[model samples]
Target: MTSLDDLPLRDDLRGLTPYGAPQAPLPVALNVNENTHPVPDDVAAQILDDVAAALREVNRYPDREFTRLREGFAAYLGHGLRPEQIWAGNGSNEVLQHVLQAFAGPGRTAFGFAPTYSMYPLLSQGTGARWIAGTRDDDFRITAEDAAAQVAVADPDVVFLCAPNNPTGTPLGLDVIEAVYEVARGVVIVDEAYQEFAPKAAPSALTLLEGRPRLAVSRTMSKAFAFAGARVGYLAADPVFIDALRLVRLPYHLSALTQAAATAALRNSATMLRMVDEIVVQRDRITAGLAELGYLPHESWSNFVLFGGVDDPRATWQALYDRGVLIRDVGIPGHLRVSAGTEAETTAFLDAMASVGSAA
Candidate 1:
């Protein structure tokens, strides 16, 4: 039998080993930063009823453009954005790919800071674009001057900013975002996957929306909104830029069920707000606990955090798993990222951490 192995792999992907098994379960699972709280029975019932009504929304297909969901999202964010300014995909991860495909490829460049989502450069390279990354200072924040210098040279076609950046959870300085937008000849995507946990004064690219046509903000319901299983993510960009996504992104990319469920959640933003408050409260508690054990996590505005040890992070991860607590090995060499869970589970995790640290 002939095999396709002879067929050449994509040139850019010839030699990279992807992260293995992101779903492997541990005794106290805290790896993915998923919302520890599931939708309550009331929310679940509403979701079911709304979905039943919306299932007949159109036998033909969902609004190929997802206009209502977009409008609802814009209103939910109170960003005054219109349907034309919005785009949705199965997840924010896909939206990241859409931006890279539309803006960066061939000889073009896509750039983001290192120790970020870790998915950005992978997506960029997949698009056949040259991917470049600059490291943040030890404090885990990137500055406007340093980022501006890279944009001046790389002149990236797409710049991904995971505000309150992943793993590190430190938001990029607002000035850095503005500088990238001001200088980049191409689009700048602000991946605000964890904005709810960020301080109110933390900088965001959303402020430059009107004057900066190339600016885009990608938001996910998976984090603060507690809609991970629903798999809904949206982008807020200039009307024209968001529309450009239509050219490359799949039509009806959002499911009727997902749209129904997510639309309902956003309609009742108060629930999400309440959940975020709980998660934030728990995050602080967990951070404080971790610190007490000499486990210093970088300042965070996200559901999870980054902490390092004097040893291999992967080993620390395996050690925790061996003890029945699952956490993330953030590929930071000697660091792991721990997400928040229920209060009881959090206590178990703290105990697990104490045991692991003591043993190490």
Candidate 2:
């Protein structure tokens, strides 16, 4: 049996742990922030048909450009985006990895507000770039002034901004994004993986893409589209910025089946996103439910809630687990996060929380 110590691993990765959430077969699984709803049957049928059709040419390499999928993404995103401005990969993680590989590696640095997405630092280190963690406002929010000051100081080659941040579910204002872009001389990425679940009237970072060649807004199908298993993520940026990713991507990185499935999902974007409205309702319900239980539920624009005031997050997490309901202990000393699931699943989680008593 060989251990990691016996292998010639990169010095930077020697003591680093891989990123992942605990996976269990618990009955009411709400960890990992996945869309807990199933894909609509009609959409699933269409995707299956598209995948089957693609199988006919499986012997050949997939469309190297994934042209139709890019067009589909442009259409879905619709800030007058064109296909040339779109790029995608296995998941948003890969999409961000491409950005780091193209802009930040060995000797260069990547920066993000601390307690943002866990993957930002991981992706930076994996690309051989140094990770610089900056501070956020008191309640996990980012202010324009603070953001500008931090970026000006770090002057990193890459910056990641998680809109409606994970772990704490705090929303990011466009002012802060514009502020960071104005100060940072490097590529600035706005990860909007949970954007579809945000308030409908909120403007996306895509709205700021024009003329800001260094800014990129990335999105994922894993949340609102119920396509997590399909693993499709994409971003909108200047055509030239999209071009830079081409230098680092592996040939035929996306398979024909994946391209087909994601395109089909995009074509039925309306139906695929119907689940978001219901998920929002559940997210609010969880917030209200937590408040009634004497916990501090943060304001969330995404399909999950991160609450504080837990005396022991691990104990509450385990108690919920024992009752067959699972949530995330996102490493915030007094906080835990849980995804908004189907109505019944949400009820189960709340009921389990009530039984655990108030840890506030």
- Provide the TM-score for each candidate, comma-separated: 0.94, 0.99
Query: In model 2, how large is the Cα lDDT of residue 285?
Result: 98
Per-residue alpha-carbon lDDT of model 1 for 1-360, expressed as tens digits?
Answer: 754456687767777667463676655778888898888667778888899998776476877777678888888766567778888888898988898888887889888888788778788888799888877887878789888887888777888888878878886767888888888899999989898877767656677688788899999989887788888888888888986787888767777777888888887777666777778777888888887887776788888877765366766777778888888877676677889777877888888878877423
TM-score, predicted candidate 1 vs. hidden true structure:
0.94
**Cα error, candidate 1, residue 275 (Å):** 1.1
Q: Which is the leading candidate under TM-score?
A: 2
Query: How many angstroms is residue 332 displaced in model 1 relative to the true structure, after the best TM-score fit?
Result: 1.3
lDDT of 2 by residue, 186-211 (tens): 99999999999889999999999999
Model 1: how far is 24 from its true place, Å?
2.1
